[model samples]
Target: MTKIVVDPITRIEGHLRIEAEVAGGRVTDAWSSSTMFRGIETILKGRDPRDAWYVTQRFCGVCTTVHSIASIRAVENALKIAIPSNAELIRNIIIGIQNVQDHVIHFYHLHALDWVDITSGLTADPAKTAALAASISDWPLNSPTYFKEVQDKVKAFVAKGRLGPFANAYWGHPAYKLPPEANLMATAHYLEALEWQKDVIKIHAILGSKNPHPQTFLVGGMAIPIDPDSQNALNADKLAEIKRLLTKAGEFVEKVYIPDLLAVASFYKEWAGIGGGVGNFLSFGEFPQQGGGQPWLPAGVVLNRDLGKALPVDHRKVTEYVDHSWYEYSGGAGKGLHPWEGESEGKYSGPKPPFQHLDTSGKYSWVKAPRYEDQPMEVGPLARLLVAYAAGHKPVQDAVNGVLGKLSVGPEALFSTLGRTAARGIDCLLIAREMPKWNDQLMDNIGKGDYAIHNGEKWDPDRWPAEASGYGMHEAPRGALGHWIRIRDQKILNYQAVVPSTWNASPRDAKGVRGPYEAALIGTPLADPGKPLEILRIIHSFDPCLACAVHLLDARGNETLKVAVR
Candidate 1:
């Protein structure tokens, strides 16, 4: 057996290292580690509960708005405060836009290259590529001349040897299965997606006052002042602009993104059985009804691939185990503790850098093993799709069925890496379709002269009880995300966030049950252990964001570890 390590996995948000034991051309065992320690939960101690959202939003630049939403929801849950109708509608629109924008970025910018071979695009016939693009969807940019121009641009960049974002990739790797024409088409959409994302963020700027990390969230509701007459606030013109942007984004998802995903999946049908880890799935329901009723994305757990029985997720049953993690639990090293009583103490006792393999018997990752009902549950788009489909959500069911029909694959195929990628595209369409409904609802509420955006009754700290605890959760673009908070005297007593990456990228637990990332790697066939593009494909499908999972920095901001991969 030989050990293969890909440390500081590229094209991702932060540091993540995957070490796998390969024997007979297949991965036998794997360890997923977040190589740095981020003490966001530790920093939140004794801070004002209302300020938690702002601080936690810094957890990750890409997921800024998600952490903020969860933090405010946690505080509101503790106070038993219900937001006004307009606030709910506004928050939904903001989050929906975030979902659409983030998914597009993930596909075109981050994960597309894993399947597309850029160098092969040079050999593609532009006319054939245009035909392929037109067959997928009636996206108007499919002219042969347009594709020829895109090919020339790529050729020029290669000639200059300045690939920029396209540099250092495992180009022409055997794992990339798309034809040259398909690759060229995907490459064109990738450039188009870059322009599309810019317009999408304008919607965020109009509503949330900023794009990356919006400051619109308040503990009880949103902070956007509503005024039809004033041009400064969320006025009529601003609403119209948002609607127009939503319509544009919806067209991109339905026409370009979803079709491209299906076209790619058709070539890699064998992937439908690979990387299906920890059949149990979890989703903390999100996007509540107009008045805080049933969530649009149903919250539940599907265990052992039994789709017929979707069980409700009880946050109380969630616990984190630090057996193979860097943190130490007060109760013991391998003991599982609820988040409200969670601890984030750093203690790195693993083999140092330049090491051959991880001491799987010892601590390996910065991410603690989070288990729901003592089982490692998979989270993210696949989990949300499964939970919603099992619950008979009409829109979700229809969207999923439409894709499955196009791919000509049964629902069982939804368990693999390709399915996970497809689920994100399908969910993006669902959220984009709902955006207009939410905008219309907000407008109707304003027309009725009900324009309240916040409830200041709980803003004062003195109004809080001596002690309270609550869980704030959202079906973030990456999957089930929850923030557990315990407050006392209006200050945060304890805080813990079990983010999506924490659930998917975690290591083994006390019972020696492998986490999703680890389990998915086993039995995977690697064509070349040295290049290991297959490993990246499966892992990137989870959209690992270790910045949200772990962090570390010295006082002088110097580098921490010096490592070598063999």
Candidate 2:
């Protein structure tokens, strides 16, 4: 048996340590650990509920808007307040843009390196690359000159021995399957997406008054004023600018992003069967229709690979277990507690860092194991897509069918690493296509003079019931994200955020059942355990945001141990 550890996995949002036991070149056992812990929930105690959104948004820079949305929803749920239709429409549009931007960044920047050999792009003929790009989509940027220019920039960076973002990669790893031209095409898009993301984020700034953390959200509705002539409100010029940006984003998703993903999947079709983790999926549902009606993404569970049997989500059944986590639960180490009554107390009882392997029998991670009905379930784009597909959501069904038809694969193929990756691309296209409708709805509401965006009825503390508790949830870009809050006298008593990563990157529970990340690593064949590029491909499919999963700061900032790998 050989142990392969990828400590502080690169090209991810935060610190994650993945240790897998390999036997005969196949992973037989694995442990996923969040080394650091940031007790954000503990800080929320005694704070005003209205201030929770601002504080929670700091949990993750990458997923700031989702956290902000969930935090407000939790407070709203506690107050039993319903936001206006205009507010809902505006929220959906912002979230839709965020999702598209996130998916694009994940594909080209985070996960693309696992598949595309950047060094090989130097060997690609720009003319052939242009032809390949042109054949796939009608993206106007697919030109020989553009491809050559990107290639030249890459060559210059490589020659300078300063790869920067392109540094420390397994450049010629055998697992890389893309052709030279395809690699060059993807590399070019990788650069293009950086610019594309800036434009997408500008939409967020336009709405929220900032990009990383949008401040426009309020407990009742949005903080943005609505007026046709007012310069400070969401006026005609801002609306037109948003439309223009959305159009550009939509064109990229349809023309560049989706096609590039499909092209990559074609070369790595074998991955369609690998990395099928836990087989259980969950989604909290997002993008509600008018009057707080059913969400576009239905909330449900798909158990044991049975897509035909999607059960409606019972939020009551959700609980977090700290049996194998660093935190101690007040009830007991092995007991499961719902988020409303959740406890987050730090207790690191395991071996310190610089260790070879985690004590999987004991506390191994800072992230608590979250179980649905005590069952380990996977969450993210794959879960959202599967739930939507199972519930017969029309947009999801149409998109899934189109992709499956193009790939000539059955639905079962989606339960793998490749499917997890492809689902994000499919989701982007679906959400991008839906963005214009949301914009139209918001515009119609404004035109009808239904410009009411905030509900000041619940703004006063005296309006509270003295004691209240509620859970706010959103199917974030990552997956099912929820924030549970308990308030008394308008002040937060307890706050727990069961983020998407907690569901996907959790440790073992009382029953010793491995979470989604560990389960997915089992049976994965490692071409070179030392490099472990295969493992990265699987984990990155989840698009982990560990900063949201676990948080801590090493005040000393000392390097304890290092092992050189050749």
- Against the unseen true structure, what C-alpha lDDT does each candidate score? 0.90, 0.91
In candidate 2 the C-alpha lDDT for residue 352 amounts to: 62
Candidate 2 residues 1-566, lDDT tens each? Answer: 98888987988888899989999999999999988786799899999999999999999888999999999999999999998999999999999999999999999999999999999889999999999999999899889999999999999889998779888888888888888999999999999999989977799888999998998998999999999989999987888999999999999999999999999899988898899999999999999999666798899999998878679998899999998888777666678999999988787777765687788778888899999999999999989999989988878988998998898888888999989999999999999999989998888888898999988898999989999998899989999999999998889999999999999999989999999999998999888888999999999999988999877565243555679999
Clashing pairs in 1: 37-551, 38-551, 380-479
Q: What does the lDDT read for residue 18 in candidate 1?
A: 93
Which portions of model 1 show Cα errors greater than 4 Å?
555-566
Q: What TM-score, to 2 decimals, does candidate 2 have?
A: 0.97
Candidate 2 residue-pair clash tally: 4
Taking all chains together, each candidate's TM-score versus the true structure is 0.97, 0.97
lDDT of 1 by residue, 260-345 (tens): 99999999888888998999999999898875568888999999998886899899999999988977777876689999988987
Error of 1 at 101 (Å): 0.9
Task: State the TM-score for model 1.
Answer: 0.97
